[model samples]
Target: MSQHALLNSVEHSDLKVITQAGAEYGDNLWFTPTFPQEFRAVSAYYPIFFHKDPATDTFHAVALFGFTHNDNLFLDGDHWQAGYIPLSLRRQPFLIGRQRFKEDGMDKEQRVIHIDLAHPRVSRSQGEPLFLPLGGNSDYLDHMAELLETLHLGMEDGQDFVENLKRLALLEVVTLELTLNDGSQHQMVGFYTIDEARLAQLDGETLAELNRRGHLLAIYLAIASQSRMRDLLARKNQRLGL
Candidate 1:
């Protein structure tokens, strides 16, 4: 397939859903389209959200599509004080959207593809308006992918794992600790891993040589040529019936 098609496929793939917090928070973090025919969808182009749980060493990932009330989405605003100064200056950026699902609980949720909205819950009140981010393809997937990579590696062996990961590839390393909607906590680490066989097969110079010359695209292409390590963990879990 063409590069464009491959990227599209990567961006549009379905997500697996899992719940790690309060049982009352419901199962399946993914959401479904609430009113696709009437409104312009913002997250449809890329519909996945990832959450990592360090305490239990689990990863919660979901893909969701749908409409949210304006009040629930994140919006840029201005802030002001009682004085003459402009209040807009005090406005801060915060998550204000709700997770809308086709059904209220996990029963039907298991049958669909969706992800939990990373924001607060949406109120069903009539006056509420859900504001959405401008980018249809938010960095949600990229963020999640990076987050999962970091968290998974950390779980494998702590600081030693991180050091080894960097030595194995040419990407920056970072870690994130997150609190999910249900009040559960988790962690994720980030780094890239390359396929040694593929790098050696290159008729030209070595992988290190390509990286040293700042051939970023070529480096990523070579790294991705290997199976995404993230999937390996997922498969391992499935094999053990996790």
Candidate 2:
């Protein structure tokens, strides 16, 4: 269960957040939602792919971390081996929520910061403080706010990008088959990747439109990111001592 509550300095002044990368803090994820703004950084160390939700029939982007669920190849002890971490994973214990208020007799909703009180990263005496001694926002909190805003925008934009890919038929379902050094086999299905042939065949106008929307770069980045899967495979091998 999540103990989500609106963050305030007066009520949570003593709250501190653990910044280290650790499985105990819920970093043991096989993959996490990713966005185009972080694509350059994410693609450097993770394979970017698209996934379709069967219930919602909506498409979204992700950064693959391992071959199976709950397996994070990036987590080595309490340290993340990657130089760049995805925004979704980095902004843990804090979530962006909406709050309503009256502004000049007009009711409006605004994005607000909410923290999970029960998270393992939450504490009083350890790690970085959320508020200063004088009840002002700490530098860490300020940074987290900016990160959340970026992530929020990125998520929205990524949804549009995926929809455009789907409309253009630039996405192709694929299966990931791998054989381990120990003669073990693994197969993963229902993942979507760029359809290079369709992408290459797109007319000039469609290509220009994609480039104008800033999705062309992200598409290329996703294509280029497939190479990182080899590194993930290597990490798995090392983990298994194979």
Candidate 3:
């Protein structure tokens, strides 16, 4: 259940948001949505992949944290082991909302921050306060606002990145079979990755165009992120005490 409320200092003066990473805070997700803008940081720690939305048949980038559903290897008690957490996860319990205001005889829409009142991260005490004693936004709240703004812009860029990859046929289906240390076999499918072979065969002009669009770097980062899969497996193995 979700109860989204437009965040303001008056109604939520005592609102304290738990900022720690833990399962109780719904941080047990196996993967999180990501964008090309943060792929450099994401690819450095997690395997960057593409996920297709079955309902819309559209694609978007993701950073994988575990092999299967609801399994986040990065979650160890209250600590997130990764050096960087995807902004999608970090901005949870809050989202961008639009408000229309009259300006110069025209309606102008502006983005506003909305918080999920029913989210597990929300609390009455023992967490970061959203507003200061004087009723102004706290530093933490300002940081969240900035993060939401960045995500709002990055999501638009991600759509273009996915479309360009699709147009170039750079996404290829991939299947991974893993045998855990405890003798459990897991087969993962329905995921895709950048087709390095096809990416290399693109004409010079197309390559130049992709580079000019700042897509080539994200592509290479996604490919380079594959190496992190080994580290992920090791974490899984260690968790299993293998």
Candidate 4:
């Protein structure tokens, strides 16, 4: 379980986070949650798809890094091969938390930064420091705060984007099957993607509405990203020496 706590300079002044990319730093994920705002960039490098959360039965957009669990073809030694990494993956060990505060005798909730002490990237030595020697937030911490804020807002927008797609009946279940060079077969199930046929059949008014909401371009980007599945298969074959 994650041991998350509100970050404080007094208690976490010595906390350091590893900046390298590798499985040791918890980079073994095959996919990460992504949002519509990041589709253009993420679609360029990774195949974008949607998966339903079992706990909530809600669909979420994701960027695929590998075909199987515990695999990330993008990780080569300590470097990430992709030119762009999803915000969800980039903002590791830190997350936005809600804090209730009294402002002018009114209770209001504010977004604050929180850290996971048990995350693998966290360390006491040989990494980026969270605070300065004189007791102030480090440059890294400042950047993290900005990243978390962006991620929070992007996710909120993504929820509405997905809801609109569902309301329009544009999403459909998709199954991917790949055959490696060595004649081995792999099948991926329970994923959803935009139905190009239905999308093409949308009325002009609906298309105009989607375009107004900026979801039309995002939907096309997701459809175009499926071409990268071939690239992912090649990476897997190369790793297997097939």
Candidate 5:
């Protein structure tokens, strides 16, 4: 679906809403009502889920999901918070995987068209077509589905094989260099970004490295761990010796 599509909840069948427990009340999406507004513009609305886990007083894992939203932003759901909350609360919300921006006062100049694989929040949702870096949505989801299947298996083996790889190699830092469809390069690190658009371009060997290293699988399992997908992944893992 396009980015302008609306996401709903399965049970409620209502547009998914996140009600943050605080004095200031957080609602809506993408730091602006633009998403809801865009939904009204078009007659398309699909189901999505918003889950929050505030196990520690310091961190929360707020997961937003859409059934058909085939974007990389949501796929990297496991790359959540690290470090302590800083004195500047300005970035604290987005840093811990919470939605911000509507309060932060983003640039109205940024048209809701182009892709921002690196956006702190927008990077994770499959809303509109902002960037086409990964190439057309040809085999993107298919490849990712297969990879996620492997991750499910690995997680079932009682070995977070991917995360272990990172800990063993001590690769806490990484530099990502992405080549967009236009051959332009965008680089970042520390829970960077990986949209389906760009992921489609990755060769099998490269994806294999990502899967083995745990970086890619970490994201996959993080998102799939709590769902039935984990069971699916586990079954696949047994078959592949993952």
Candidate 6:
């Protein structure tokens, strides 16, 4: 159960958030949603893949962190052994919420920050403060606001990015099969990858259009990130002492 509420200086001015990487703080995730804006950084460290929502049928880009659920090879003790952490994971315990109000006699919706009091990272005694002594937003809170804005805009653009990929028929199902040093077999299915053949067969006009929209680079980055799968396997092997 989560106790989420609108963040306010009056009632929750003393709130603090832990800024550490560990499974105890719920950082053990196999993947997290990502966007094209972050593809350059994300691709440098993790394999990028696509997953479709079963209920909405909408596609989302994700950064793979491990071979199985509840596993994050990048996590070592209380530290995240990665150069780049996904924004979705970084913006923990806080989420963007919509609030409706009347602006100039017209209904309008605005994004607000909501914090989960029950989050493992949430603490009142020891952690980064959310507000200053004089009731001003703390540096951490300001950073969180900026992160939320980036995430919101990136997700909006991601929807269009997925739509464009669908239009080009560049996405195809993939199955990843791996054998561990311990003689354990693992298979990952229901994920999508860029179809290199289809991408190559696109007409010049379409290619130019994709380039103009800055999506061609993102597509290539996603494709190139697949090489990191080997790195993940190596991490797993190291963990297993094999």
| TM values, all candidates | 0.18, 0.97, 0.96, 0.98, 0.18, 0.97
lDDT of 2 by residue, 54-102 (tens): 9998888999999888899999889999899999989999999999999
lDDT of 3 by residue, 1-242 (tens): 99999998889899999999999999999988999889999988999989998999988899999998889999999999989999999998899999999999998999999999999999997789999998789999999999999998998999999999999999999998888878888988989999889998999999999888889999999999989989999999998799
Cα-based RMSD of the predictions, in order?
A: 20.3, 1.1, 1.2, 0.9, 22.0, 1.1
In candidate 6 the C-alpha lDDT for residue 182 amounts to 89
The number of clashing residue pairs in each candidate reads: 29, 0, 0, 0, 16, 0
Kindly report which residue pairs in candidate 2 clash with one another.
none
lDDT of 1: 0.29
| Top candidate by TM-score | 4
**Least well predicted 10-residue stretch by lDDT in candidate 4:** 18-27
TM-score attained by model 4: 0.98
lDDT score for candidate 2 against the true structure:
0.93
Better of 1 and 6 by TM-score: 6
lDDT of 4 at 113: 90
Model 1 agreement with the true structure over 144-233: per-residue lDDT tens digits? 344444333333332232233344443332343434344555554432233355445654444455445434333343234223224323
lDDT of 1 at 121: 24
lDDT (Cα atoms) of all candidates against the true structure: 0.29, 0.93, 0.93, 0.93, 0.29, 0.94
* Weakest 10 consecutive residues of candidate 2 by summed lDDT: 51-60
- On a 0 to 100 scale, what is the lDDT of residue 217 in model 3? 92
The per-residue C-alpha lDDT of model 6 at residue 66 equals 94
